[model samples]
Target: MRALTVKQPWADAIAHGEKRIENRTRPIPPKHLGTTILIHAGATEDFNALPADMVRAWPKDVRAVVALATLAGCHKAAKPRCCAPWGFPDTWHWELKDIRPIPHPPRPVRGQLGLWTVDDDTLAAVQRQISIERTSA
Candidate 1:
């Protein structure tokens, strides 16, 4: 599966269904639309950089794929609107849906820019985790 590395708080927010739109400086490729992708939490964190309210809800895990979400669509934002709460002017907003957390990620992996492929072993592990989550639920 393809994955995107997003910074903390935002990644956590998306995983927990708190954020529905991901703001990007550039648009995602058209082919990615309607695709299910892994949501990788980046390794870096700057608690001081985030707003106080956001810092309170931050997830502890970093440098791992925390969730899976469908890339519902990508749109160009003419201005800051309801879709993206932290959106910047003229940025691309990627709509995400069906966000589900992995609970315990299979393993940690370094993140990269754009959409990157997940290794088979890791993907299988993630699938196992998903299976466990479903059965338990």
Candidate 2:
């Protein structure tokens, strides 16, 4: 299983299905996609100006929560334009469907991107139930 580390609120939004875009680079090529991916809810640099669509769908009780979500699909945000740049677009959008709050993740790192492989035990730790108490702190 390949786990992806994502920033804060976006991770939370993904967990609740409010946000579809991971808002960063693709962890790996579309082919490298393995059996499952873990959603690492770490901190993000910017305060999302949050789009209108996001605000409408965002869980009302949500507060800077981080969650682990399984990947469903990865697609381009829009048609790739010709005049952009040398490399792929700065943003590689991902769809987060099966999302759950990861209570405690090991080596919880903070960054915009990184895809690493994890074993069964780590997977179990991620799948463990989270006590969703209180609103965002």
Candidate 3:
């Protein structure tokens, strides 16, 4: 599976909050649509974007995989403020669905810029957690 490293509150929003749209400069590649990807929280936090109270509620798990989500679809922001507060003008809104948070993050690992591939060991660890999640559900 592939992974995408996102900034603090945004990543948390996808995992535990009600953020279904991820605003990016580019759209998700056609091939990756509908693929399940890991949501990794980068080391840096974007305090300027989200409110302080919202950020405080999110788990501070930097450089860690927070959730598994499906890259459901992508669409350009046709209007100035199309997708509510999360959407930005002139950016592609990558739709995320079926978000499943990893209760216990696997071993901490560095993140990359875009939709990067995860190593076999890291994939295995994430798989284990997903298995547990399924059985519990």
The candidate maximizing TM-score is 3
Ranking by TM-score: 3, 1, 2
Give candidate 1's TM-score. 0.84
TM-score of each: 0.84, 0.53, 0.89
lDDT per residue for candidate 1 within 1-137, as digits (tens), equals 78898887777777864788888987878777788889998888665655677767656478888898888887888643656465556778888888889878755888998998988887888898784222110
Better of 1 and 2 by lDDT: 1
The lDDT for every candidate, in the order shown, is 0.77, 0.50, 0.83
Off by over 4 Å in 2: 26-28, 32-34, 44-66, 79-90, 103-112, 118-124, 130-137
| Candidate 2 to native Cα RMSD, angstroms | 8.5
Error of 2 at 80 (Å): 10
Clashing residue pair totals per candidate (backbone < 3 A) = 0, 1, 0
Question: What pairs collide in candidate 1?
Answer: none
For candidate 2, the per-residue lDDT at 114 reads 67
Which order, best to worst by lDDT? 3, 1, 2
lDDT of candidate model 1 versus the reference: 0.77
> Which of the predicted structures, 1 or 3, would earn the higher TM-score when compared with the native?
3
* Model 2 lDDT per residue over 16-116, tens place: 55565564555446664423455655554333644556546544322222465555566564655421331235566665555665555544343344666
Candidate 3 matches the true fold with a TM-score of 0.89
